[model samples]
Every structure is written in structure tokens, then in C-alpha cells.
Target chain A: MRNRTLTTITVVLAAGALALSACSSSKKNTNGGGLGGGSSANNGGTNQTYKIGFVGALSGPNAQLGINERNGATLAIDQANASGKYKFKIALNAQDSEGDPAKAPAAATALISDPTVVAVIGPAFSGESKAVNPSFCQASPPMPTVTASASNAELQNQGNKCWHRIIPNDNVEGSQGADWLARTGAKKVYVLSDLSAYGAGVAGTMAKELKAKGVSVVSSGVDGTTTKNYNPIAGTIAASGTDALFYGGYDAQSALLAKALVAAGYKGRTVTGNGGKSSVFTTGAGKAGNGWYFTCGCQDATIAPTAKEFTAAYTAKFNTPPSTYSPEAFDAANLLMDAISKASASGTATRTSVLDALNKEDFTGITTQIKFQANGEVQSSSLIVNLFQEKSGAIKGLGNIKELN
Target chain B: MSQSENWVQQLPQNIIIGLEQGSVYSLIALGYTLVYGVLQLINFAHSEVFMAGGFGSYLVVNGIVGHRHMTGVMVPLTVLCGVLSGALTGAAIAWLLEKVAYKTLRRSGAPKLAFLISAIGASLFLSNLAGKLFNRLPNNAFPTYFDINHQLFKIGNAKVTLIEVIIVGSAVVMMIFLDRLVNRTKLGRGIRAVAEDAPTAALMGIDIDKTISRTFVIGGALAGAAGFMFGTAFGVSNLMGFTPGVKAFAAAVLGGIGNIRGAMIGGLILGQAEVLIAALPFVGAQWNDVISFVVLVLILLVRPTGILGERLGRAA
Candidate 1:
């Protein structure tokens, strides 16, 4: 009787373990493999609820920025419904990417397999944007996506036509920054990169443009995203005594490097590309980041007359001030809605029609007048060069957004 | 501006940087070495042990120090509190890991591969735990107590920062203390005996499980201390452990797995090799990781037993 009971217990435990492993294995498959029940089967008729998918960071340090972007898209969807512009009621399936490339493909695939998602607003960051491109592009008719802010030049080079950006690519900002710095009479500049797909692309492009403009690049090194000790690199910078420094990375590391550079006796000017335009950048550097130049594709919304209405609407809706990239995200969301509207005016608005409309998209948004190039890059007025001053330590815009593609 | 043209100019600073980095690797490597020495199992979860130490330090410092400028009594006080918290955290977690993950398996005479997989699962669990608890930002700089970059002195053109001084000094002191503990003490004999022949050691009146547990404590303490140092210098993050942990493990294999001094030597060598390769003219820093691994592969190919040879692993 004891032996029979033991055998029964063993079988039960073995079955439980097998079931557990099977569940874990299935989770992995959904994340990595193709979505089994493809998107087309779920496409509802004109009266069904349509979702404009949004994917980006929503739960980390950059959470505020991503939330603002997501909120912007959400607001656009709400506004479109209120206007009664389309037969279908539009909503948002805003997935949290947490700004990780590893998490992006799954998010993108999930969005792709939702047939009611007529368009996607973003995979907001450049790195995540790149990772999710395959999902959008490889879809049968291709899902159209208009990004709020992913500006890595390589994204356009990927030949992913379905993915469009309202913000000028880093190629514009890097080239313009390099041009401005060269015009400032700096003989040499040290270029530093975080080596992310975004940072490297911008820094590399800037270096090429700097060399072309007769500015000598001293030594391009690293300000690694996770690296804390900047002294060694800073020492090299001080010893090299380059006339200026161009950092291509996010605000946090840029600030850290700026402080390190100051401590190492570097008195040269520092210029950060689009990625380093947050309050964290300045605060992290303390006094060191003051007077540093930061470039971006969007002007400060508070000062722009056209942006005033959007800013007020945003504040009223979200009950908070718009953060960095929020206005850009707002414009991007409107761009998507506009594309949908244009596609539907002539005939039934489908994924292919919406994508075709986005390809030739031209709209005067609050930030810039958008026109996409053949590479799916937005043609903005000009890239904004801002100074991280004591007053406007969070990247004060000097002029218009650049790179009309 | 012309620094890249002269390889000699870049070499000294790179070497100093390398040594500072190697010190952290050596501390973490010691954990892997000590555990591997006795159990004949590579404790992959040891990295998470180091990572836990960092988070532990961060919480301690944040609670005690708040955000204050570095100076006066606060500097040493914060350091002491943080390091202690880190060490305790590391020791406790590592002990629990051994108890929950490995102890039962060891008693059941599970295969070595099972231990490896278990260690990996434990590592993932701890990392995710930290992530969930502390939002998964890439970095969260501890409130500045002092400028870690204030130059202690210059070696050639290299500016040796205060942080490097702290890292190198603390690592050396800890490594020495551990070496003496392992070589000279009565407990050391028991540990060595158990490693040599556990059944024989048990017959000879040494408690096998106790000695193994104590070995973990020592290794974990070292890693915890290293984690604190790494946090102060690099800023604490959830993903911080994996890279350094892997590098330290590489240092372990490169030096001679299961050997104490071998890990130290391997770490410094690997660190210097990485820095030196990155200091090369043009395309330097871009391929540093690649070259570091290449050197390791080359060295292992030349000497399979590593520099000091496989001395600590039990020979069946």
C-alpha cells in the first residue's frame, strides 16, 4: 500500500513539472517567434474600434518623457473621436517598452498582430525603434508608424518605408552642430560616443561632417552608458587639450562626462547632440554642464506661437507640463491621424493606404512643417542649437528645427 | 589633439585605468575562485551576489547620507556604513543561495550541470528582484560625497583619481587578508582538506558542509566589498554585475581556475590588455572588448591549465 502511494505521488509531481516547463516554453515562443494567429483575421469592419499602437519606455528614468509621448498619442486619438472624423472609433494600445531593444520586438509583434491598429505612433527611442522595424516592415501590407522622436540616421537607411519620423534624423543635428562648432573657430574637437545605435550613428556622422568642414577630430573615445568612471577618459581629454568636445549620448552620461572633464581641467566648450537635452543632463553635471551646447530637432514649445495651443491643451489634459519630446510626440500623433483621415477621404482607410499617405505626408504641425523624404525621414525647417546655460540648463533652443530631410 | 599619434603617450594612463578596473575584477574573481576551488562548481550566481551588494550599499548610503557634498566625517562614515551593508548583504544572499539552490542538490548527489543551471536561474532571479525593487534605470548616481575624480597623484601623464586609490587600496587589503586567512588559519586547513578529499576530510573530523559554507562566506564578503567600491566609482545599477562578473570569471580561468593568486594576476593582465588594446591609434576603443576576449582565447589555447595551472580543483 505504501509503495502504491509513493508511485502515485511521483507521477503527480512529474506531471506538474512537465506542465510548468511547457508554460515557460510557450511564453518564450510568443516573445521570439512569429505571432501564430496573423493580423488579417482580426481586422474588423468600419464600425469596429481601431487602435493606434504606441510603444516606448513607460516605467524607468525616462518614464516621464515616454509617458508624455504616449499621452500625446492618446490625446490625439481622443481628439479624433470627438471630431467624428472617421467611421471607426480610434483608441490607443500603448505598450510599455521600458526603452530596451530586447523588449521591443515582442511589443512590435504584438502591435502588428492587432488588425484593428491602423497605425503606430512610436517605438519612441531610436534603439527600440530599430529593433521593432522588422515587425512593421515585414507585415504583408506593412503597418505604418510615425515616430515622435527616434532620430538615428540608420533607421532611415534600414529601407523600412512603413516607419516614418516627424523629427529630423540625427544626421541633420550632428551635421548642423559640427557646422556651428567649426564656425565658432575651434581648431579641434574631441568626439565621444556612448556607442548605442543612436549615439554612434550621430557621433560618427558628426565626425565625418566635422572633418569635411576642416575641423580636426582629436580622439573619439567613449562615455559608456553604464560606465561610471570618466576620469581616465577625462584625463586624456585634458592632456589632449582639444578646443572643444562633442558628446553624442543621453543626458545622464553626458552630464557625468562634463563634470569629469571639468575636474580634469578641461576648459573647452562641450556640445551634445540631440540625445542629451534633458534637465538630468545639467543637474548631473551640476556647474559643469552650464554653458554647454545641446542640439535637437525641436524648439522649446513654450516660446513658439503655434505650439502655445498644443501646450495649453496638453497641460489641461495631462494635468502637468509637457516634458522633452512631448510636443514632438504630439505632432507625430496628429501626423498619424492626418494620414488616416487623408487615406479615408477618397476610399476605405486600410493599412496600405495609410502607409502610402504617410510616405507623401506634409503637414504644418506646432513644432515644424513635416514632409517625409524617400527614406521616410521628416523634412523639418532646421535643427535647433541650444545652449545649456545657467538659466536654461535644460537645452535652450536657439532657432528653428532643421533638415527639411 | 594629437594624442592618438603617440602610442607611448596613451599607454601609461591606460595602464592606470586598467589596474583600477582589474582591482574590482580580482575581488569578484576571488569569489568564483574560492567557490570553484571547493565545490568544483562555477557559481554563476556569484555575479548577482556582487550586484546585491551594490544595491545594499546604495540603500544604506541613501538612507544614511542622503544627498550631501563629500567631506569631513561624512566621507569615511558613509563608506564604512555602505561597505558593511554591502558585505552583510552579499554574505547573507550567497549563504541563502547555497542553502536553497545548491545544498539540497549536493546532498542528493545531483550532476555538476544541474548546479550550473541552478546558479544561472538564481542569478536571473536576483537581478530581476533588484530591477523590480529599484526601477530598471541604467544608472542611479549615489549622492556625491566627494569628487571621486580629484587627483591623488600622477603617474606619467595619467591622473590617478581618488576613486582609483580607494578601489586599488581596498581590493589589495581585502585580497591580502583573504590570502592569509586561506593559507595560515586552522579553518584554512579544514577548507583545503575538504577540497582535497571531502569524504576523507569528513572522516578526519572536519564538518564538510560547515567548511563549504564558510568558504562561500569568505568569497561573498570579498565580492560584496568589491561591489561597494564599484558602485561608488561607476554608479549602482541592476545590470552592473553581468559584465564585470563575466570578466572576473574570465580572469579566473585566465589566471588558473580555483587558484587565489592566479585570479588576481589574470584580472590585472586582462584589464591591462583591454586598456592597452583600446589605447591603440584609431579604431582603438571600438574593438577593445573584442581584443580582450581574443587575448583570453589565445592564452588558453597556449596554456590550457592557465598561467598557474589547475591547482585547486579536486582531482578524481
Candidate 2:
């Protein structure tokens, strides 16, 4: 009788363990293999709840960008829901990617598994966008990912039918940045990247442009995300006697690099791409951050005439001023909503219908007029990248990138 | 200039930077060595202890120098306050760790493997707790009261900043103080005795538990102080300790895991190797970690035990 009871307990425990392992294995597979059996059959009707998913860095070095984007999207969603123009209610499924490519797949998988999610706002940085775009494109109905800030030029050529970018890619920003640098009379430039898809792509383009412009350029790579010490790299740059240092990475690492360069007595023109345009860089670099230059496709919403009302609303809602790409995110969210609205006009909005509508969208936004080319690139005539400088510890806009040349 | 000339020009500054980086590693490594000396266990949670010190000091420093332009004597005083607070916080956490993770497990007669598991569990809990409470940003700078990067001197075209001076100077002083504490005092003797043979030491009227606890406190104080210097130089964050912590652990092993002096030497060597090798014109800075570990492996292969192989019982 005792042996029988023990055998029964063993069988029960084994079964429980097996169930636990099975559950965990499924989660692991979803994370690794991307979303499978992908999109759910969701019919967007009156009073139906649809989730607009956002995947980006909610908490990390690049969190300000994601948070800014999230806030803008949130405002757009709130405005849409309150307007009562749409028959369906929109809810945001904001997922944190932590600005890491390795962590982005899981966040993307989470959104794809949900049947109600028709559109995604961002995968934020270019590396994450690259990592998750295939999965998004491979989803059953192809979940549409409308990115606000990912600017890698090669992203549009990935053959992902559902991927759309509202910003001008690195091909424009990088060449424009090189032209500006050359106009600055910098004979030699040291180009550095964080080795991310975005950083490398932008830096690569900049190097090619600089070489074409007859400027000597030296290129190197570093893992900006985990590296805390930039002193050695600073020493390398200082010793090279480069007239300018072009860093293509996020704000936090750039700030550290700026500080290290100062300590190493490097008196060169320091410039970075849009990724380093945050107050995090300016503040973290302290006095060293002064005189650093930045190139960005984002507009200064606080000063822009068209963005006055959006800025007021954003500040009132989020308590902080709208940061880089906030206006763009607002536009992207509105564009998505317009697509969703169009999709639902005839019948119910599905992932495929919303994507089709997105491909055909041509709306005027605060930043620029948005329109996508056949390859998911923004083809706006008014698309502009601006040059910004940190003077006396505050970032000041220095007009347009094209005009600088 | 030639390629080698460039490296030669940059050598002095790189050495100064490496020294600053190495000193912090030494201070943290001392804690790991101290714990291992008595318990014969690697406390994986020591990294979190270092991180906690940064946050603790950040709160104190931020409270004292909030938006105020500190001048004159107030600058050094504020720094001193930060270091003291960090040390105290680290010591308190280490004590709690010993009681909860080590003592309880030992009292229950748990296997040695359980201790390692518990230490890791404690590390995860503390780091996540820190993230939840403090800023989760990876580079949360401490409130800047003084210019941390003000150039104090130049040697061979290499400038040395005030923060570097403070880091190396304080690390040397603390290591000396720790050396005396482990070799001179009655507590030191007790700790050495316990580390040598806990059962026999108990037989000789030495309180094994108390000595072990004090060892942890001493190590914790040093690490906490290092955390302050590190945070001041880089920035404070819940996750700041991982890299330095890993480097310090390797340093401890490189110098001889249970030897106090060995840990110090190991850390300094590791730091310099990382800087000099990575600063090579052809190699680049991305190879910093790989080069340092390669040096460590080479050294270990040559001297299997470490650079200084004597255990804490004899070396301390």
C-alpha cells in the first residue's frame, strides 16, 4: 500500500514537471523562430478594441527616444479615441526592446502573437529593426511596422513588404553630414561606430562620402552599448591628429566619448548622427559636450511653426518637452490610424488591409509631408536633415543640412 | 609621425587612465578575496554589493549638492561624504548577505553548491531591486558638484585629471589600511585563523562566525569606497557593477583568489594590460577585454595558482 502511494506521487510530480518544461519551451521557440502561425483573424468593427503595438527601448541608454516616441503615439491614440471618428477603440501595446537587437525579437514576438494588434510604431534603432523586420514580414498577414526614427539606408531593400519608414535614411543624412564636414575645412576625420546596424551604416556612408569629397577618413568600430571606458579610444583618436571625430552611436556612449576626448586633450570637431541628439548626451558630457555638432532628420518641435500646437499638447500631457522623433512618432501614429480608418471603411480592418492603406498614405505631418515609395522609403520632397550644435551647454539649431553645403 | 611614434606619444596618458581604472578593480577584488579566504566560496553577489554602494553614495551626494555650485572646501567634503556613505551601505549589505545567504545555508547543513546558487539568486534580487528603486538608466551620473575632469598635471604630453588622482590615491591608501587590518589587528589574526582551519580555530577559542563576518565587512567597505570613485568617474547605475565586478573577480583569481595582496597586484596588472594592448595602433580599443583575459590566461598557464600563489592564511 505504501509503495503504491509513493508511485502515484512520483507520476504526479513528473507530469507537473513535463507541463512546466513544455510551457517554457514554447516561449523559447516563439522568441527564437520569430512569430509562427502568425497573425490572428481579427475583424475591426465598431466598438471593437484594436491594439497598436510599439516595440522600442522603454528603459535603457536610448530610453528617451523610445519614451518620446511612446508619448507621441499615446497622444495620437488618445486624440483618435476621443475624436470618436473611428468606430473602433485603439489601445497601445508598448513593449520595451531596451534598444538591443538581441532583446528585440522577443518584444516583436509578443506583438505578433496578439490577434488584435494590426500596426506597430517602431523597432526604434536600426539594429533592432533589422532583427525583427523579417519576423514581422513573415507573419501570417505581415504585421505592418511603421518606424519613426530607424534610418539605415539598407533597411528599405530588405524585401519586407510591410516595413515603412517615415524618416530620410542614412544615405541622405550621411552624405549631407560629410558635405557639412568638408565645408568646415576638416582635412582628416576619424569615423567611429558602435557596430550597430544603424551606426555602422551611417558611418559607412559618411566615410564613403568624405573620401569622395577628397577628405581622408579613418574608420573603426566599438561596442558602445556595454563599453564603459572610451579613454583608450580617445587616446587613439587624439594620437591620430584627426581634424574631426565623427561618432555614429547613441547619446550615452557619445557623451562618454566626448568626456574622454576632452581629458585626452583632443581639440577636434566632434560630430554625431541623430542618435546622439538628446539632452542625455549634453548633460552627461557636461562642459565637454560644448561645441559638439549633430545631424538629425528630426525637427525642433518647440521652435517649429507647424508643431506649436503639438508641442503644447505634448508638454501638457507628458510634463516634459517633446524630444527627438516625438513629432515624427505622432505623425506615424496618425498615419497608421488613417490607414486603419480606411481599412475599416469598407468592412473590417485586418493586418493586410491596414498595410495596403499604409502603402497608399500621403498625409501632411508637422515634421514633413509623409509618402512612401515602392520600397517603403519616405519620398517627401520637403524632407530635410538639420545641423545642430551644442553651444554654451545648450543645443541650438543651425539651419538645414543641405544649406550648410 | 610614424605608427609606433603615435603609440609612444599616447602611452603616458593611457597608463594614467589604466591606473585609475585598475585601482577601482583592486578595491573591489579585495572584497572577493576576503570572502573567499574565510568561506572558500565565491560570492557572486559581491557585484551587487558594489552597485549598491554606487546608488547609496549617489543618494547622499545628490541630497547634499542638489543644483548648488560647490566651491572651496565643500568639494572635498562632499566627496568624502560620498565615499563614507558608500562604504557604510556596502558593509551593511554585505553583513546582511552573510546572514541570509551564507549563515542560514550553513546552519541548515546545506551542500556547497547551494551556497553558489544562493549567492547568484541574491545578486539578481539586489540588482533588480536597485533598478526598481533607483534610476534604471545605464549611465546615471552622480550630481556633479566639482569638475571631475579638471586637468591637474601633464606628463610627457599626457594630461592627468583630478578624478584620476583621487581614484589612484584613495585606492593606494585603502589597500594599505586593509593590508594592516588583515595582518596586525586581533580581528585580522582571528580571520586568518578561521580561514586556515575553521574547525581547529573554533577549538582554539576563536569565534569562526564572527571572524568570517568581520572579513566580509572589511571587504565590503573597500568595495563600497571603490564604487564611489568609479561612479564619480563614469556614472552610477544599478547595472554598473557587472563589468568591473567581473574584471575584479578575474583579478582576484589572477593574483591568487584567497590572497589579499595578490588581488591588488592582479587588478593593477589587468588594468594596465587592457589599456596598453588595446591602445596598440593596429589592435584598436574593442579588443580591451579579450587582450586582458588573454594576458590572464597566459599568466595562469605559466603560474597555475596565480602570480602570488600563497593562500590568505600565509600571505595575509
Best by TM-score: 2
Per-residue lDDT of model 2, residues B172-225, tens digit only = 999999889889998988988888888999999998888888888888888888
Model 2, span A188-247: residue lDDT tens: 999999888888899999999999999998888888766887877888898898999999
- lDDT of the structure predicted as candidate 1: 0.76
TM-score of chain B of 1: 0.96
lDDT of model 1 at position A56: 83
Give per-residue CA lDDT, model 1, range A1-405, as digits (tens). Answer: 544543343344345445544444344333212121222123465554556778887665455557667766666666666776766566666666767788788778878888877888888888898888878988987999888778888888888878788776888878877888787798888888888888888898889999999988864657364466575577667667579888888776887788777767888888887677766676667667778877777657666788888778778877876767888887887788788878877867889998888887778777777888787776545334333333445555566423211
In model 2 chain B, which range of ten residues has the least summed lDDT? B307-316
- Candidate 2 collision pairs: none
| CAPRI rating of model 1 | acceptable
Clashing pairs for model 1 are A379-A404, A379-A405, A382-A401, A382-A402, A383-A401, A383-A402, B70-B145, B70-B146
Best by lDDT: 2
Flag regions of model 2 displaced more than 4 Å.
A1-46, A380-382, B313-316
Highest DockQ, which number?
1
Interface RMSD of each: 7.3, 8.1
